[model samples]
Target chain A: MSTISLEQIQREMAAAVMTPLTPDDNMRKEAPDGRSMERVAASFIAPNSRLTSFERLEIYNRQYWYRVLGALAEDFPALRTVIGSRAFDAMSVGYLKAHPSRSFTLRNLGGQLASWLTTNQHFAARRADLAVDVARIEWAFVEAFDGAEHEPLTLEQIATLDGGSYLALQPHLQLVELTYPVDDLVLNLHKQEKRQATEAGVKHDEDDHAPAKLPPIRRKPTYLAAHRVDYSVYYLRLNRGEFHTLRAIRAGRPLGEAIEAGVTTARVPAARRPQLVRQWFTAWAELGWICAPDLDRLVRST
Target chain B: MKNQLNAMLLTAALSGLIGGTTVAHAATTSASKTTVKAAKAGLQYVNGDKPAKHSCKGKNDCKGQGGCKSSDNGCKAKNSCKGKGGCATDGSKMPKAV
Candidate 1:
């Protein structure tokens, strides 16, 4: 009799559990390697009086996919709404299978969704770019909700800086340049989801209810920052100049250079530039965005 | 001239020119709708905690009272009030038919 090691047994069971279910959501009768599932199941799972070894193992297979799928649905509710539940399910399966859960927490599951959608556009049902943007904002929401917090620099600290000074943005702040005005769309979808979740007190399958219908979203180049304020996540809109300037500063550019980068492409007139930059800084300070940059680096650069 | 202009702008901004209503007023221009506002979203569910409404047929709406566990018709599960109890699938898979 061949004695199996505990590790070997776990490997076999795990492989069996993760195998894609049949169309009917049942465990396949045969393994992908053409081995009889009955024989394979008997090797590990003991048959109960009412259930065969295959049937017993099937329970686990079903539970694994169900829990993971439902978990993903919870995280990307907005994405699911954008590309109806039916397509969302398909995308979830493909994404999970490719990047199987490696982290102890499922919170990290949809981290790769936006990048995955960039290549797998068909999953969005013709709303490929919009789907990617929505996925980006949705994931940003997750990060901003729990990302780190840092104290912003005061006006005195701001006054001491020349154009060569370096600045840091808050850790929780996320910047996204989008081709669609998706910030509003995502917020609306989330509100609509809450309304439905409240009304039915349940989120039913796509078949039971009509597919989610969304308003026609026109393409508009929008720059947004998803940031945390008083523990609540807020979406702040930005102009082209502000976005690039912040981008430059975040990239470690000195204040002068960052402002120069911002000013050249700025749409605000020359006379308005100074006043506008001052206002942007005021908002940044009020919003606690301009945290202290690396002191050593700042000192060295200055 | 541009570099000099940028330096002057930086000097004027960094000086005690904040807290002025003139600029605060400018901040509210229609194009400058940059106010901070939070979205009051109440959707709640952990990763694996089956949503209370996750019914059997891949529809997570609800499993009303006294319904069948695996049937397509309006059959509710025996345990409607039981929360986070266990994963009970009705033989339906994702990205595919239930």
Candidate 2:
């Protein structure tokens, strides 16, 4: 008798976005409510000669899931190899449930997948921490490669740095500390995946094999420095001394204090300490990883 | 009075027939409105033919094979393995209930 309420139409739209449609589902406008799922489905598509409106809607519903899942699968190839196909697909579905696509672009679909994987019930049963670590590394690679770039600290700026000034790293540069050799594992798994892909004419759904359990991490926490260099991206791993020194510098400590912190954290040998510091500074300078202090402007203001 | 009632009934029936068929005609026009169905995906190297930008469900249903690989990769078709062949390259194939 009256027009369909906007709220009812919206509810149906949300339902369509979230779930798959069936041919038998009541989407036709024959009902009194005028909110038939059939009409809503029909509105989005034309009636095909072969298939009904419900059947046509199924194509889009399935494609939406497949596209999002495909992006996640591409981002975490190593993770897929470790968990196998079935478990990975299940994990992907669960992640999508918790964090649906909020961004306009599908590229941002799996923004929260790494954290979700870390806490997922399935992951906890296996190498949950390792999975998260691998995901973090993979995401960092994606960001570094595709993210916007800025002017890196030039060699000229590093040459004139004052002794009392501290160096600042770029905001894009990210530091990650992990308990597992996730980087190595991720690389190894990718290689194995390529081999398996070549051998099989078609990938089987049964490729979901449990990953081998890893030995307990005995080394100090592994430090990773991720940033873009020139047009390319690279992740230069840091040792204990290097990691501590960079951490102190990033904390706005003066060069002397940063060196002290590195010594305290890593217990550098007295004989090799000076050489290590020199080498570290030279490497940082060469890589243009450090920004000079803006002391001249500060002085003028004061 | 009886004749007038019969004339009204005939008019109502004729209108109903026109209304239903018109709705059907509108639907048919909408279906064939578009001249081009599939657009070019632009990756000429992967598959020999220019990839179809648009697709339908059974388009890749892979009836030729038992099942089709389900991937959301924008480059490849959903169910059908265009020219790249099956999941041999990407290792993406349909999951069968085991």
Candidate 3:
């Protein structure tokens, strides 16, 4: 105790607290670094009149799991809907075990969820692809809500650019290519959650809100731009051509090349190409999704 | 020739944006509802008035947010939209992880 530094104490306590809970949600009798759990707790945490050091430390262990699990639940309520409360809870535990709270805020808790789901598809259960889609769209919502915003380039500014001029989307803008039209599914789940939250006057616990069997959602190839307008976010559906074009722009293709790339992929015939592309630009401008990149920020955001 | 055609098309698109007359949430907003295929959950109101709300830190300030906002501060001006930012209202840093 005399020689141990404060940093060493923090590292030890954090490790002990973050150890995985047993299936029954109790602290293990052992620690990862191969020390007696009781002795480890007694060294750092002092025992009080009633509770021993190990017992007091157990409270923190239980709480560390509870708080992180709950925060994950809030961030991905819709994913909880797609996969039941039991599986979501279990998967969340695994996710946290794999990717613990690295950032200062829990806002980035599910940052790697969609990517993680791809590798851990078993947690997705019967509808693995749909679950992945739901996770992707849900994470997009988190990003769009708090991700950075930028002043969009004006029409006049856009006009001067040749095909080679670089352009980018707003930092908060997220382009998601999903297999199912999960945008609607998430909207329905969140709306249901809000209504229930309002009526119950409190949010639901995991077991409390184990949803009843829902009609299976069908697969539909969907292209979406999850973007913020005036601070409120929306899922703007995009045609394939528009999706590819915008993707190219975000990828740092020049304006002319990006448009050409999009034009080639346009599902509509050449005659209707101009009309659809026109509609996309008008909506994007109105929504302020187009931005002139700050080179450093652009590199990091992509 | 293809580049010329693209340039022409780009010009027309820019013209619509600059004109600012045609309000085009059509491709964006209209399609959101029209394409819904979903399963709804928790329709029953189990708790009345002040229901059984729970928070980790014991203060219930955060409203449940979905893919959308709970209380929409609809677009006030064309440029500024209302959104719910971070809501960690525990008023203390120690219990933030709790």
Candidate 4:
């Protein structure tokens, strides 16, 4: 008998657990050519009196997939609702196969889901665009929930702002400009799910648990701000001008330049520009979305 | 030779056992039903009881009206509840449409 090193054992275990489950076989045959699924399972897993070695290993394999799938479903409830349960299950399995959880935390599991769904439109068929929008917003919510935090700019600080000064946004603040009004859809679905959970006194465990029936999706330009206030994530609706201005600011544009860009929006009337800009800053300040720029660092750089 | 024979017999028995269990598992799982064995194993992870945040309670206009209603001037948008209710700054309010 050949002695297997700890590294080899770990590698084999990972391969076995990562591979999708099979019906007749406990492991997929995609393991290294020489090591059959049975051989890999038997090598590391020890069977108890009641369970066989393969069955013991199978337990881990099934749990690994279920854990990941459950995390994804929790993250993207609206996405799951948009595409029915059976399709969601199949799509999630395929997505995990393509982009396995590389990070230690399950929080980053669906990081690549929105992009993945774009290329694989067959998953949602005609509703592909809607799915993409929901996925993006949901992922933003997840990111904002535990993303980095920063102190917001105080009104006193803003009172003495210079034109040359640049403003920064909170680290967790996310601005998403979407084609369909999916922000509303995501929020509605989230509320409905919560209501159902409350009324039933138990959370919906099934992935395909349909949310209350939603209205037909109509294509309308939507802007959304996903930000955390007091450790809770909330979605704020933005108008066309506000979205453009904030996006410019987030993209590192100076405050003056960002305001100029926002007010110059073709959709916004030229006459109402000044009042609109004032209102935007006031509301953003109240919401704690703006952060004071590091003036010391800026001066040193200059 | 005796050890090899024992290994072969064990392999055969394991294959039969796995096949039967797999079929049974598939039938129950596909129907979105968990079997007693699976339930006992505690396969599902329930999320914590933190309720969804309601920071944007009156803000969201998913029900249709009062989002970005266009006034005579242009788009008069409100963070929540249009026309001078909550949130002091009415940035969306313009003098009159030009």
Task: State which candidate has the highest lDDT.
Answer: 1
**Worst ten-residue run, lDDT, model 2 chain B?**
B36-45
Q: Regarding lDDT, does 1 or 4 come out ahead?
A: 1
On TM-score, the leading prediction is: 3
Q: Report the lDDT tens digits of candidate 1 across residue range B1-98.
A: 98778877787556423443234344446453343222221222122222333233223222122121223322233222135322333222445566
Can you write out model 3's per-residue Cα lDDT over A130-165, one digit (the tens) per residue? 889988888887676556777677656766765567
Q: What residue pairs are clashing in model 4?
A: B73-B97
The residue ranges of model 4 lying beyond 4 angstroms of the native Cα positions read A23-26, A29-35, A155-160, A203-213, A293-302, B1-98
Q: How close is every model to the real structure, measured as TM-score?
A: 0.73, 0.59, 0.77, 0.68
Distance from true location, Cα of A209 in model 3, Å: 5.8
Ordering by lDDT: 1, 3, 4, 2
Candidate 3 residue A107 C-alpha distance from true site, Å: 1.0
Per-candidate DockQ vs. reference = 0.09, 0.01, 0.10, 0.01
Best DockQ among the predictions, by candidate number: 3
Model 4 residue B53 distance off true place after TM-score fit, in angstroms: 13
User: What shift in Å separates residue A24 of candidate 4 from its native position after superposition?
Assistant: 8.9
Q: How do the residues B1-98 of candidate 4 rate in per-residue lDDT, one tens digit apiece?
A: 64443333333322332343344345456753333323322111112344533222224331112112111111122112233222222223545777
**Model 1 lDDT tens row, A1-302:** 36789998898888888877876778999887899989988897666455677877787787667766766786678888888888888888889878876665555677898999899989887788999999988887766656677666665666578877778887777888888988877887777777777789766654423236778889998888887654456777888888888898888988888877887788777888887787766666555677679778667866
Q: Encode model 4's per-residue lDDT on A157-230: one tens digit a residue.
A: 55555544587777677887787987767777777666676799855455344333568879998888887654
Looking at model 2, the pairs that clash are A27-A37, A27-A38, A27-A39, A28-A38, A66-B72, B39-B53, B60-B79, B60-B80, B69-B94
Docking level of model 4:
incorrect
